[model samples]
Target: MKLNRLELDFFRNYSHVEATFHPRVNLIYGDNAQGKTNLLEAIAYLSSARSHRARYDRELIMLNEPQGYIKGEVDSRERTFILEAKLNRGKTRQLWSNGLRLKTAGELAGILTTVLFCPEDLYLIREGASARRRFLDGAICQLRPRYAQALAEYNRLYEHKTRILRDWQENPSLLDTLDDFNLRMAQFGARIIHYRAHFVRRLGEQAPAIHADFSGGREQLGLRYETVSTVQDPLGSVQDIFESLLKHQESHRRAELDSRQCLSGPHKDDLVVELDGQSAKQFGSQGQTRTAALSLKLAQREIFQQETGEWPVLLLDDVLSELDGKRQSFVLNRIQGGQVFITCCEPEKLDGLERGKSFQIQGGTILSQRSV
Candidate 1:
């Protein structure tokens, strides 16, 4: 996947800006807080439904502005497509593709897959389990739309089941409804777990070598899916796990009271990153953590390529300055023939990269594009 042109209006600091991008690499350079990273964020928002940096939609719009708009032309898998996103408070966010309105966001997932590497991503190892879970969900959502749908349904079922549980506590007569909710949620939850397990298994296969290259063979990296429920020989099929989970929901409901539902399920699942025999979150050094995160993202791009028959667009938000020469070179070499959007404060930091296009950012305006 590659973005060919980007247009932003009232997005962050940019009032109106349009730029075309090279297929291989496009670098945006400026001082800190000059909207260099905001350009990348706009692209990410266009690809996905949400902003990569902002916690909410109102923050993404220019101050005192009613809405923010992003439009982009992209090429993926031998087809060219156009995507547009509009963010407005107090109304549902709207999306359009090729000038047609989209009823759902899942329609936009596979059209422009992206792997974003931001400075905050380095905290994946040290942060809570939710961050790691978000990473896996975001990556898989792009490749498999069903995973996204299942996750959404599971969340809804979880909320419904929690409400039913509250009613059951009061009357004890809603047990049947509670059981029905549990069975439905377990069915979908099992499917999500199946996909997550397969995703982590694939990452395990690809991340070790990449991590070794980044860490100079000093550590071995491993990825594992941590689920609360156990799967016996039925691991081959999620249907089997669903049946097993349903069969035990009655007992689980009576014994488990810490939360609204049983704790042993995909909702509580986690992705464990290990270095050698130790947990990376607990034992890895600062550099080790960052390198491991970088390797995981690179592996994600390759996995998306192998599974989808196309490369995902890579977004590097001011990450080049954080890496040493060898590590930067390793990342740059791996991204050949793929579209890349990188943000940096100093153009001199990217001197060794070959055949790249550079754009200067001042405030919210982008200067002329040049080849360096």
Candidate 2:
């Protein structure tokens, strides 16, 4: 997949801008805070209908602007599509594909898949479980709309169950709805567990080899999906996972009531990273941890290509500057055969890369464009 053209109005620092991109690699160079990352953020929004850095759409709007707009022309699988998004300050965002309004953001997935890598992702190995779970969910949500829907339902159920548990003492009547919420949670949570387990399994199959190569065959990488203890086999049928979750919820009923917290289910799931049979988070060195994180992201790209028959657009947002020379070389070498956008401060960093397109950004505008 490739973004052939992009236009932004009142998005981030850009008041009005438009640029064309090459199909292979596009290098965006500028000084810090000159809108390099903001350009990438716009493309990311077009791909996923959400911003990776901003929590609210209003944050993406330029100062003093009531709304922002993003439009992109995408080329994927011998077809062309126009993706558009309108962000408002105090209202819901609007999304469109080829002039047809989309009712839900989930419908935008798989249209222009993207795998974004930022400096923060280098800490994926050492971060908390929430970060790891987000990595899994982000990738799966792009490929499977059903998984996204199930995840949303499960989160809603989890919140309701937590409220019931927290206030049951004051209003004992709340106990009446606890079982209903638990059953719904288990139903949706089981699907989530199943999808996550399967995705992790596929990721595990691809990441180890890449990690070995990145480590020069000196280390072996491993990934383990950790779910509720009662789940005997995460990759099993939905009925099996549902029954297991329900059983575990029953087992933890008293403890949950005492603690007044929802404590059972896949919401607490984690993906364990092991390097040579050791916990990477706790035992791996800085360089080793970074390599493992890089390997995992590359593996994600490979998995997308394997499942979709096309490489997802790769976004490297000021990440190369954070890596050493060796790691940088390894990353650039492996990210071939796909549409890539790399944001950096130094143009020399891309000296050895194949001639693609290069753009200079200043004050939220594309100052110039040329062949690299």
For model 2, residues 133-216, the per-residue Cα lDDT tens digits are: 988988988888888789878888888998999999999999999999999999999999999999999999999999999888
* Model 1's TM-score against the true structure: 0.90
Best by TM-score: 2
Alpha carbon deviation, residue 27, candidate 2 (Å): 0.8
Off by over 4 Å in 2: none
Compose the digit string of candidate 1's lDDT tens values, residues 82-112: 8999989767789999999987666787899
Model 1 lDDT at residue 135? 88
**Candidate 1 all-Cα RMSD:** 2.6
Error of 2 at 148 (Å): 1.3
